[model samples]
Each structure stands twice: as C-alpha cells, then as structure tokens.
Target: MSGLETEKELAEEFVLAAFEKDDRRTIRRMLTSDALVYTPNVPGPGLDVDEFESQILDAFHGAFPDLSIAVESLVSEGATVVCRFTMTGTHEGVFRGIEPSGETVLVTGVVELRLTGSGIADVWQTTDSLALLEQIAAYDHENVRGERGS
Candidate 1:
C-alpha cells in the first residue's frame, strides 16, 4: 500500500490498541519518542508520548476497562490522517477525580495524526466532552433527588 494508506492503517491500529484492546506495547511502538498530542479537555500546552500513554491511555483504560472505539471514517492527505470515531464505555473506575458513576457514556470525536518515517509525529484530538459532562451531571442529579426522597 501507499504511504498515506499505511499511515491511515497505523492510526486505526493505534486506536484499537490504545482504546479497545488496551495494548500498551503496541501503542508505544506506534508513537515516536518525541510525539506530541493535544486534546480538548487537557490543560497546558499538550502531552508528550509518555504523558499521552500515562494520562490518556492508562487512565482511560483503567477507568473504562470495557471501552470500545469504533472508527466511523478516515481520510488522509500527505503525511496526515484524520479519523472520526465513537467511543463508548462504562464509568466503572474513578476518572478525573470523579467517583465511579457506573453510567455508560458514548461520545464522538475526531483525531488528526501526523506520521513520520519513525512513527506518529503529532496528534490533535477533539472530543464531545460537553455531551459527556452533561450526561454525568444528569446522572448525579438523578441520584441526589432519589436520595433526598428516600
């Protein structure tokens, strides 16, 4: 396959391994040593490869052990691949200082990956965090109302 095609395929595999399969080794292999990733929810400049693995990969995988990400579409130009995906998982473990809510959340997001000869050079991601936070807040409110009634 062509280089663009290869990059697209690698992006898919990276998503699968990191989000679905929780295969850290494969994820490490896919990212370059100096890879940078930016996410909408994160503060500061961005995350390096190690921070991405620890904060994003490890944290999400731990919080949502049954997490699944389905790639809805992918397109590529030059060394960049853009992927649109849907992520679904149950909030069974503490995440972002929130207790386990046991609520299932499904969110859609897009990720753009820049690949180099070594591996992934950079990534930019935008996820539907507003929708996710709304759901979680609703769940909490419902529980609070129920507790007050009882």
Candidate 2:
C-alpha cells in the first residue's frame, strides 16, 4: 500500500483501539507532541493530548462504561483522514454534572485528523450532541416561577 493509504489505515486502527478498547497506551502512541483536538461540545481553547484523554476519552469511558464506536466510513487524502462513526453507550455514571440517567444514547459523528509522521497532529470533530442530551432528558428542567409579595 502507498504511504497515504498506510497513514489512513493507521488512523483507523488508532481510533478503534483508543475509543472502543479504551486503550490509553495506544492513544498516547498515536498522538503527536503538539496534537490539538477540537470538539464542538467544548468551546474556547483546543484540547491537547492530556486534555483530550482526560476530558473526552476518560469522561466517555466513565459515563458509558460499555461504549461502542462503529466506523461508518473512513476516507483519506494527502495528510488528512476523515472518519465517520456511530457511538452507542449507556449512561451509567455521572457526566458533566448530570447524574446517571440510565439512558442508552446513539450518536453519530465525523472526525477529521491531520497526520504528522506516524502520529495524529490535529483533530476536528463534530457530533450529534443534541440527540445525546435529549436521550438523557437533559432539558427536562423545572420551570422557574416568579412571586410578587410586598
């Protein structure tokens, strides 16, 4: 296989090994020193390798202990690889201050990875976050009422 194809294959392997298997070693090996991970859910500065592992990776692992990610498609061109995947998991642990809802959520997302040498240099990701929140009944909040008493 050509170099680009090899890189794409490596990236695919990295995603599966990291997310599905929750293998921290694989993740560390696959990310570059200056890697940047961008996610729509988290605004402001981009996530570095440590932040991605702790916030995104480990958080998901904690929330959805039995999470599974299925790759729908993987396309590569030059130094970039785009991955489309479907993630399904049960809400079993506290996530982002929300208690366990015991809800099973299925969300789809696409990740664009830029490879440097044999490691991923940067990642841009977007997912169906609204679906996840709805599945967990995140919007089922009590309405506030105002009282007038003088």
- Which lDDT tens digits does candidate 1 get at residues 1-150? 887678789989887887789887887788888889999778878898788878887777777889999999989998889999999999888777767788898988888989888998898977787666665555465676799999
lDDT of 2 by residue, 1-150 (tens): 888778778877877776688888887788888889999888878899888888888878898899899999889898899989998999999877779999999989888899877589888877787777778765632332222321
Off by over 4 Å in 2: 138-150
lDDT of the structure predicted as candidate 1: 0.83
User: Cα deviation of 93 in candidate 1 (Å)?
Assistant: 1.0
Q: List the RMSD of every prediction in angstroms.
A: 5.5, 5.0
Instruction: Give me the overall lDDT of model 2.
Output: 0.83
Deviation from native of the Cα of residue 116 in model 2, angstroms: 1.6
For model 2, how many clashes?
A: 0
